[model samples]
Target: MNDYIIRATAGNGAIRAFAATTKNTVEKARSLHNTSPVATAALGRLLTAAAMMGIMLKGEKDLLTLQIRGDGPLQGMVVSADSNAKVKGYVFNPYVEVPDKYEGKLDVSAAIGHGNLSVIKDIGLKEPYSGQIELISGEIAEDLTYYFAKSEQTPSAIGLGVLIDTDITVMAAGGFIIQLMPDASDEIAEKLEEKINRTPYVTSLLDMGYTPEDILKLILGDFDIEINEKKEVEFYCNCTRERVEKALISLGKEELEKIIEEDKKAQLHCHFCNKEYNFTENDLKEILKNAL
Candidate 1:
């Protein structure tokens, strides 16, 4: 698979690890959103993390959403994923630009500024699980590491990166999520941390022709690592015209009447995919007839 995730365990199940290569998935999002380089990096990082986290869900229909609401130029981002690794997301200000912190690196922290990261998981339950954390760092990876440690009480190391080409297209994008399972020993955890500290940036490894499997091997090669599952992930949105029609219907009879009277037609846009659904006057009238 071109873009895929690998799930593995090591240290006799004392550690759980997930690695993914999401260049194509992120490129599709860049083309769809026309995101600037900084915006692309930030969104790509979150999308990659979301894909890995989504796969952690047990149920086929389980959903995960990662949202960052910040005070910087890139106002916020919202990414949603399913257990099967289908993910979609959007940035509030795709064109927002910021100066690089260094000569080459994109300043994702500046783009995101201070923010709150919210993780919402909708499993097959009456109410979805939600957790919120003040972002320790606006860099998507660190914030998520903090999220895992604080909210889930799982010590995790997350590394995410997005490399932008000269022409403003995605060159490489991917990440790894390493967690210390409850049974993990201090020696194993320390060794894993040391390995991560010595490891190169995920994008650098990916650009050097490393696959997800290779990444895990490099990080946990000595831990008796065993691969459990592998799955392809994509930038997918499940929005349809029928679903859009249902949304319009939910706008209420009076609201639909007002829209019909004023505009003579209606146009709705899907935030996740930038798809526009248009309804002519007749279409609006027909929809109004079915309004609740």
Candidate 2:
């Protein structure tokens, strides 16, 4: 199935949720970055979550960025997404070898160690809104749950998972976010807790060929599942040669002259997509005119 996200409300809007299946998107990321199995899992989970969170914006040009600065072998992970559910990200150390935390599961927490989660939203405001919290667990879900509750003051349940295949490809990857409204009744909240605890892991649901809608129905079935919107999500990076050239122009006349004088050429690597942009001497000189 194509990767997509479902936005919905349940129990008369007292509960809002989002769910998505991101196997293909995660697999794409693994291939582009050539991440190790453990790094793939860690990056996949974060990317999946970021895809859903990106669409939470109400503006056209809004952007959301999630950064994980860890203290383990993995070092860090950075994901940036737009309101269109187009997400791109990378790991600080994508090939760090680490033992699995469980018999058949990747040890994301140990690979990521403990650090901070930073959520930054640029919504055409005076300043981009920013929030940070200590990682409750290096696993993306729990850390996000803690982020929502403490940073946003909204009690939430977040579950994210990435299953790796024997060949080191992504087997499954998906997640769900359920949040309680301010006036959610105690009874309904209790029921939500019960249902969530009984439900299977997000990746398990995806492995069974469950769609985002099906996953939400499994959790929000007891409540009225009012799906709001559905949108395709993908591993997309919007970096272009023109944009990279503009950046080089922004470096000013002296910087461009030095590059033209010393290196005569430059290669720019985009972290989001691992694509390299080459600038020859003539290209740099052309950019230099604009810089001057």
Residue pairs in clash, model 2:
none
Please write out the lDDT profile of model 1 over residues 1-292, one tens digit for every residue: 4899999999999999999999999999999999999999999999999999999999999999999999999999999999999999999999999999898799999999998999999998999999999988899899999999999999998989899999999999999999999989999999989998999988789779788899999999999999999999999999999999999988899999999999999989999889899999999999999774
Q: Could you give the C-alpha RMSD of every candidate to the true structure, in order shown?
A: 0.9, 1.0
Q: Give per-model TM-scores.
A: 0.98, 0.97
Model 1: pairs clashing at backbone N, Cα or C within 3 Å: none
- Model 1 TM-score on a 0 to 1 scale: 0.98
**lDDT of candidate 2 vs native?**
0.92
Q: How many residue-pair clashes does candidate 2 contain?
A: 0
Model 1 off-target regions past 4 Å? none
